[model samples]
Target: MAKKVVTIKNLEYEYPDGTSALKGINLDIFEGESVALIGLNGAGKSTLLLHLNGILQSDEGDVEVLGMKVAENIREIRGKVGVVFQDPDDQLFMPTVFDDVAFGPINMGFSEEKVKEKVRMALERVNMSGHEKRAPHHMSLGEKKRVSIATVLSMEPEILILDEPTSNVDPRARRNLIELLNGLDITKIMATHDLELVSETCDRAIVMFEGKIAANGDVEEVLTDSKLLESHGLEAPVLVRLFRDVMNREYIPIRLEDVIEKPNKYKI
Candidate 1:
């Protein structure tokens, strides 16, 4: 059996103004599983993510990561779980790409040589190896997003949490981001409005609505449910809608490649 990397029980949270953000969320994420958290605005997806790394502490529930309680082992958990925010600008504050990528490893008490190695490897992983000296603010959104990922990658986190990763990028950049995410062999929990990204990169889909988990299941099972998605302010992927609604096909294809590779399977 796969190890459970993150466990949440009866998780609840409310804002300072008494706006309930999360209402008794219970979830478990297994090792090396890529899960997508999909929901509309004002849902509890972001709030739920904040609790994973101890950014938000709910008075009502328990959150555990790597078998360690978040409330008690916050510092250690933060090191092992890296969060990349929705905006690259929010993550990249250092002057240069090298500085931003090296910040995490350096703060973790790594020696100078180790920090250099970590930075180099992280940049290489993101395919930004030769652009270390470039200023992050000057880079395009796509480049900055990769560098933001590199900053977290430098720490060598076991779990990566991303918020709106494909949010403000062109089609080419979005495709690149998806490929990059698919290549990484680590536990990933992403909160996104991009259903296409979820279809291509995640093994499971979790739908959040009105501060609670509306649905949770395999990627194909959840994403293909047009009714469930529609009720919760989401829609099936374009290809799924086309096959089920337009073509009136019983067989549903979740990803674009699925339809491309086996056209006869989806034909009625």
Candidate 2:
């Protein structure tokens, strides 16, 4: 098996006022794999993400990124785990797109030329090749979201952690973001409610409920389990539910792309 890139064990955390945010989360993410962390509001999804890159320290247990402990190796872990917060406004605080994208590399002490190069390459990856001078405040929300991702991409992170990549984006912009993420070819851990995006982008799924990992397994296997989904305030994909009945099979298709593999064997 590949070396675990992100590892957590018995992780428990609480806010300053003693509001328990996470109970105990144990997970392992392999290199270059795409995984989704799905749960309802107040489910500790975002709190768990903060632990990944050492943004918030755990009261008990530990977090390791790239084989280094998050507490002692926060510098290295931050570089390896690029966290794009749920709100782009939280991430893209710089005056201009180029400034925002260049923040990470600049903080890492890259030279001017190198930072500029990284910014350009990251923007190009998001298909926003010429928005360097644009202020983040002036850009639309969708554009700011892409630029926020570019900020992390500029740092060349080993794992991309996105809180909610599709929230509030228009359908067109959401599709564009999906395609952008798909083309990145980097290890990703996304926390989102968009099951459609999860089905299309993630190879595996992990569900969190009240700070506990309620379910974890192959994306198709878990996402199609209507009983499990319903119990956790989620729903099975409509097409997956329909195919489950028509095929008279235990397993259901999770993504439209899967239909191509067995076009005649299954129908919606």
Candidate 3:
């Protein structure tokens, strides 16, 4: 059995202005699972991701990551779980790409050589190598986003969480990001409304509505349910809907890889 990397039980959160952001959210993310959180703009997805790394404290429930309670082991939890925010600007504050990527490992008390190795490995993972001297503010949004992810990857966290990763990127950048995310070997949780990204990169989907999970299951199953998705301010990915409704197909293949690899099997 896969170990549970993240567990949230009856999680609830409220803003300082008395706005409820999350209500009774219970979820368990197993090791190496790529899960997507899909919902509308105000659906608490960002708030939930914040709780995973101890950025936002829950008002009424608990979150555990890698068998460690977030409240009690916050420092350690932050080190073990990395969160990439929706906007790359929010994460990339260092002067250069190298500094941004090396910041985490350096703060973790790693030696200079170890930090350099981790930075190199992380940048390489994101395909941002050879851009170490580039200033973050001068890079394009897509490049900034990649460097931001590399910053977190340098920490070698057990869990990787991202918000709106595909937003504001070009088509090629989005494709590159999908491929990069798909190749990662750690548990990944992404909060996004980009159904295409979800279909291509994630194995499971969690639909949030009014701060609660409306649906949680296999990505294909959840995404194919147009009724459930529509009710929660979402829609099936274009490919899924195309095959299911227009192509008169019975079996829906959500992932691009699956659709391309088994085209004959999906025919009605």
- Candidate with maximal TM-score: 1
Better candidate by lDDT, 2 or 3: 3
Report the alpha-carbon TM-score of model 3 versus the true structure: 0.97
Compared with the true structure, what per-residue lDDT tens digits does model 2 show for residues 138-254? 888889889989999999999999998999999989999999988988899999999989988989999999888999999988898888999999987777877776667544678
Best-fitting candidate, measured by lDDT? 1
lDDT by residue (tens digit), candidate 1, 1-268: 9999999999989999999999999999999999999999989888899899999998898999999999999999999999999999999998899999999999899999999999999988888999999999999999999999999999999999999999989998898899889989999999999999999999999999999999999999999998999999898889898988898988999887887898889873
lDDT of each: 0.94, 0.88, 0.92
lDDT of 3 by residue, 1-268 (tens): 9999899999999999999999999999999999999999999999999999889997599899999999899999999899998899999998899999999998999999999999999999999999999999999988888999999999999899999999989999998899899889999999998999998888899999889998899988999998998888787888888888898788887876787788789863
Superposed model 2: Cα runs more than 4 Å off: 245-251
Q: Give the range of the ten consecutive residues with the poorest summed lDDT in model 1.
A: 259-268
Q: What TM-score, over all chains together, does every model reach?
A: 0.98, 0.95, 0.97
Q: Which pairs, if any, clash in model 1?
A: none
Query: Which residue segments of model 1 deviate by more than 4 Å?
Result: none
After superposition, the stretches of candidate 3 with alpha carbons farther than 4 Å from their true spots are none
